[model samples]
Target: MPHTKTSDEVRIAYQVRGDGPPLVLLAGQANDHHWWDGVRDDFTASRSTITIDYRGTGESDKPHQPYSTERFADDVVAVLDELAVDRTDVYGTSMGGRVAQCLALHHSHRLRALVLGCTSPGGQHGIERSSEVRRSLVQPNPVDARQALLQLMYTPAWLATHPGPYYTLGDQSMPTYARRGHLVASNRHDAWDALPAILAPTLVLHGTEDLLNPTANAPLLAARIPGARLELIQGARHTYFEERRDLASPLVLEFLDQKVPLQ
Candidate 1:
């Protein structure tokens, strides 16, 4: 229920779990701090996991203006500043990853390691969402929208075995205006040219079966960031980290703990 104010005066809500070295978690569009609920336990077991709602979502201020990933990145730094965390590991997925890219470029001083999950560098370099998937993302009906999104984010085989729990949670209260703002921010995010500026040890994790962000984005992102390591989850989709956090958390833990090679 705590909040931090950005330079632009937007208040972002954040939550901290567990206790250890800091680990900031950025959520995707329309998601707040609770978006990481699926993996919080895993991440918190070894790290002080921090998750925040981007402006215009969850408990954060909903400013009615075109949003950009850069601003979202600044919000992350703002939260870290409020907590007096000089530097810590940061991980982001989807829109959150786009924001993390901005953070690495503009606020590298606050990060020890960077993890980008199922994300892209935007501006044509990112993956293209299929028309159906795109429509599903913006579907007006909440239930129908969630169902549609689940289909795209999880493979049919995975969905068959895992049902209810994975589908029951989210920020759910995201307003239409806020959703549009995040969509605008996501579309405007273009960090490809600036990726080389990231000095933090970086890891780009993607799923072999991702549809929304696409598997092709992994290599492109890894190659652009200086010495970024790319790891692929076989048969996984956009929500791989959530669906298989049990399998994916170790990879993140090792990377953040510096047990694995950055290359």
Candidate 2:
């Protein structure tokens, strides 16, 4: 519920919980801080957790203007500044991973370790979701599109066990322009050329069965970021960190535990 102001004066909302070394949790496209609900306790048990709502989502001020991953990274830095957190580990999912890429690139000194989950680097080199999968989410009926998204997010078994009327992480009632801005920013992310320059020790985590950001992109990210480690969660989909946290959280926590020589 705390807030900070970006250089451009947009109010960014964030929450800090627990105690110890700081770990920042970045949410995916259209989602807010609540996106990390499933696995937050794992990290917070040993590290302080900082969850942020990017400029256009959650309780943050949403200006009807262009949004870029680089700008979102800056918004994150502003929150860290407000809290006097000089360096911290980062774990980002989906579009949040793109913003994390920008953070590692543009603010390398501010990071300790980085974790990227179920995301792509964007541009021509990255593997995109199949046309069939993409089309499923853009259906004419909003209800149908949401159902398609639910399918992509989890396996049929999980969905069968958890009945819906449940909404996704991001509020559906958000301004249409904010959603469009998030989409454009995510589409335009291209950190391939600059990835090797990243100083933080990094981990790339992806779902083996992710339909949104195809799993193949995981290796590309691991190969590009210097000394980055990759882990693929089997039988998992786009929100695997939530759906398969038993497999994913331990990997993230163990990676975060290893010491990296300070920059």
Candidate 3:
């Protein structure tokens, strides 16, 4: 796994693939780079994709204290600096979306466009996970966590057709120790007040049937960010990318292509 050392001296792991305009992907809470596997080829086919494991997830170094959205956002900046990418498109889901929003507010010059999937503006608009789900995430057994997460992440139709891949992804992803810290970090994040400061062209994608993070937050995000558009994937759940990649990928690619324009 490729690794980059942040200013804080934390080693972050990431993978850069394909060849086209750079598009950095940020995974959601409790997920690693593997979260993008189902849709990576779709994006990478026409865009350079960089998938990263956040500070306390996947192969990245897991630190015990000082876990904040601002710090994670800095990690994204560190990755971009290491890659020498002046400006690029950003795609983030769930907790990653929060980081993307933070990036726009704090590092607007680094982004050409932003895509947020199954995410929220944080603070009051973001849905809090049920106590049961919260408990499972904090405990973090790969198998138990996978099963528990699947219920909250995927719709019934997706669970039926792609059980194998979903299971495989869960098995390969979800680091026990790292995920625990990530879950704790995510619970503390609230960005509702900061949405209006984001200046990049923004797209918010949500699943209509999403249980984990309600779709109701999409319009709120769109209304806040200037020129931000909202799209709701019908019958989709939290894992909209994995479940409806055909629908989600094309929309995302088109949006990025239109706003950022690959060279």
Best by lDDT: 2
Backbone clash tally for model 1?
A: 0
lDDT of 1 by residue, 179-219 (tens): 87888889888888888889999999988989888889999
lDDT tens digits, residue span 195-217, model 2: 88988999999999998889999
What lDDT would candidate 2 get against the real structure?
A: 0.89
Summarize candidate 3's per-residue lDDT along 102-220 as a digit string, tens digits: 88889999999999888877776776656766787556576787676677788666677765656223324545666566666677778788788888999999989876777887888
**Mind sharing the TM-score for model 3?**
0.90
What is the lDDT for 108 in model 2? 90
Ranking by lDDT: 2, 1, 3
Residue 112 error for model 1, in Å? 0.9
Q: Which ranges of candidate 3 are over 4 A from the true structure?
A: 129-148, 167-177
Highest-TM-score candidate: 2
Clashing pairs in 2: none
Weakest lDDT window of 10 consecutive positions for candidate 1: 163-172
